[model samples]
Target: MEKNDFLCPHCRGHLRPNNKIILSARTPDNKVGLILLSPELGEYSVVKHDSFKIKEGEHIDIFCPVCHADLGTYHENKNLAKIIMIDEKGIESDIVFSEIAGQKSTCKIHGDQIEDFGEDASIYTNLWGATPKY
Candidate 1:
């Protein structure tokens, strides 16, 4: 199995995943926070927070404590997460999750689709270009 590691866009600090998918973070309020990215093709990110002042089912901003970079926003209501990923060569891309119409996710570069995955939709692996619509 190919290993995928998420890194901080600012410091390149490896955002190591725990037990295959859970990524830990420190909330802006200085409390431990968490997000879990499922291994499924169209997996969604599950976020759990306590200290942050977020209403239930609202999007919460997650930041990297090391560099204070905006990692992404997570919302448990829709089971959605949006993250900006930077590749090893300094290339950047967008990753988003949507649970509507079945769980779906996509990785895009400059509006061009890179990887598209869906639960009740066509699943494409090793993709590059062409965004997938849920």
Candidate 2:
């Protein structure tokens, strides 16, 4: 197991299995598939069956594979999905990332502190009440 583990905010079910964060996803057309995301934050590499075709810039809905809860609804922004991250020490944090295909943005929030990652992270910085950079 990695030092950090991803989980469903609703069910608190372990999402990281086999070194990958497995999520249930649905395309706009109502196609469902299992999406395997890298456990490392900011790593955009994705693994899924070829039949689950997703176009860049398209919107995808993410869910907890264990409980079937809509992860995206947990966040105020519909464009993002939220998950729970627990470190080896048992400290928990909120991990938010874009649900838009090909969009590179992720944020780790622990208490009042927010750590942004990826080039597109700045786009949602203000959503968390963080001062936007010029």
Candidate 3:
């Protein structure tokens, strides 16, 4: 989805779907990692090379879809979303309302959490995971 389509349903706040959903590895020692999931294909794509550099006690910005409210920050590793997935045939599928693992707030306008992974996330994930020729 385009950026214009991203309006908080509650406060109507604008949300930019960030292609990079940062994560920190829990097991095998504390290390940062990036899992590029194709939002369009709905599957894991590739792992990033660089480790995510985050400061302690830092909160990232999470937007609410229903009300456009700014849900406060969360731990890096706790924010996991199955934004994309892939089938056996290598066809990509976008999951619009996939469950996000670490969402911990409600929307200001609608008083609900943002459940839908917006179109920007979908398109970004697809482009990131797409083959070079495509």
Best by lDDT: 2
Cα RMSD (angstroms) for every candidate in the order listed: 7.5, 2.2, 14.2
lDDT of 2 by residue, 1-134 (tens): 44798889998999987788999999999999999999788899999999999999999999999999999997678999999999988899999999999999999998888888889998899999875332
Over 10-128, each residue of candidate 1 has an lDDT whose tens digit, in order, gives 56665545433444444334555655555444555454554533333334455554576655533333334445555456665655544232335444443554555555333433233
Arrange candidates by lDDT, descending: 2, 1, 3
Which TM-score value belongs to model 2? 0.94
Q: Each candidate's TM vs. the true structure?
A: 0.46, 0.94, 0.24
Clashing pairs in 1: none
Global lDDT for candidate 3?
Answer: 0.32
Model 3: how far residue 47 lies from native, Å: 3.3
TM-score of 3: 0.24
Question: Which of the predicted structures, 2 or 3, would earn the higher TM-score when compared with the native?
Answer: 2
Q: Each candidate's lDDT (Cα)?
A: 0.48, 0.91, 0.32
Error of 3 at 29 (Å): 1.1
In the range 17-74, model 3's lDDT, one tens digit per residue, is: 4653322232223443433333233233434465554333344333454353433322
Segments of candidate 2 deviating more than 4 angstroms: 131-134
